[model samples]
Target: MAGRQRWMTVVCVVGVGMLTTAGCDGTAEPAAAPTSAATRSVTPPVPRDLFSPRPEVVRTPQEACGGTPFRAGAVRAYTPDGPRYDGPGPHPVKLLRMESDLLGMGPELPYQWTGPRPAQLVVCEYEDETFDSRQVGTCEYLGGTVLGATARVQSARFVYRVFEARTGTLVRQFTLRGNTTPEETCPETTYAKTALYDQQVESKDLVAKIRPLVERDR
Candidate 1:
C-alpha cells in the first residue's frame, strides 16, 4: 500500500489459493555471531501482529447480499480498475477480475483452466479478510549493530461470490474461510539478500482450517 516498501517477494499469480513462490533478490551481512552473555540474551526483533481485528459478528451470504447475489455481466469493463483475464479456455465465462494490493508482486503463472467452461461463466471474487504488512529495524549490538526485518500476513474471506457471465446472475455463493496466511517471508537477518523463510508456524493452523474448502474447489 505504501509505495512499494523494500524487498517484496515476486509471486506467481495463477488462481485464488493457487499461489507459489518464485525467486528473490537482496542482501544482508551475516548476523554477527553472539559472543557474549548479553548478546545471547538479546532476542531478535519480531513484528507486531499485522492484522487488524474484524467485527465479532459474522453474516451469512444470504444476509449480506439480501438473499440474492451481486452479479456483473462483464469484468473487462472493470479491467482498468483491476487486472482482467479473458476466458483462458473455451467456456463462455467472458472474463475474470482480480483486485489486490499485491498485484505488483509479479507476472501471472502459466495455468490451464481444466473443466467444462461452464455454460455460464462464474466470476469468483476473493475478498481479503486479513492483510497485514509490518516491518522493524534495529541496532543489535547495544545500539551498535543495524538490522532490518519485515513480515506479512494475509487471509481471505470465506464467503466468495460466483456470478453468471452473460446474464449477470448470481449463483453458487458459499462461505468457507480458508488459506489464512498459508505462506510468508521475511527479510534475511544478517544480509538483506538472505531471503530467509521466517514463516510463523502458528499461521499454519489457519491454513488447515481453510484446506477443506480449497480441496473442495480442486
Candidate 2:
C-alpha cells in the first residue's frame, strides 16, 4: 500500500472562574475587578506522526535465498535497543511472555539452532504502550468547588524487519499499531492499570505470516 501522512489533533479548552470571599456577616463579597491584557492568537506547530505506514515485503525470502526450499546455517534475532525492563524491578510478565512466544517458534522454523553465526536476521523494534493523565478542563460544583478533569491516553507501536545476513539486504517488513482509546474522568483521577502486551498483533500471527517467506512449500 502507498504510504500516507497521519496526524492527530488535540484540542484543549480552558475555563476561568471568578473567586469570591465570604464576609463575616455570612454574606458573599463581590470578586475583585478582573485585569485584562491584549492577547494575540499564535498557531502552534503540528507534531509529525511518530508511526509509519505498514511496510510491504521488499524482497521475498525465496528470492533472497536464491530459490525455494530455503535453508540457512543459522537464524538470529536482533533488537537495536535490546530488551527493556521497566524501572529497577524484574522484567514485566508480558514482556517475558512475548519473548517466550518468539522462542517457541524456533522448533518449527527452517534454520538450525545457532545465534552467533547468523545466516538470516529478524530485527525487532518495539515501543511499549504508555498511559498518562492530562488535565483537559475543569469541573465546578454547586458550592463553587472546582475540580480538574483529566484525560488518559495510551499509545504504542512495533516494527519488524527481516534481512539477509550476508548481504544485509531487507527482505520482509511488518508494522503493528497499538490499540488505544482515550478516557476522560472528572476530579483528575489516577490512570488505570493497563496490560503491557495488549497489542493488535501477536507473535504467533506474525510468525504465520512470515513462515511462507522462509519455508518452501512442501
> Superposing all C-alpha atoms, what RMSD in Å does each candidate have to the true structure?
31.0, 28.2
Candidate 2's residue-wise lDDT over 86-174, tens digit each?
Answer: 23321111111222243231112323312333233443333333333233333222322243233333344544455544343456666
Q: What is the lDDT of candidate 1?
A: 0.33
Q: What C-alpha lDDT do the candidate models reach, one value each?
A: 0.33, 0.36
Quote the lDDT for 215 in model 2. Answer: 46
Clashing residue pairs, candidate 2? none
- Candidate topping TM-score: 1
TM-score each candidate.
0.29, 0.27
Write model 1 residue lDDT over 1-218, tens digit each, in one string: 45757775565533444554532233332333334675455755655545564433322323323332333333222112221223232323321323321332211211222233232333343443453423222222122325433333333333345543333345455544333232322222334412322122233343343333222421
Best by lDDT: 2
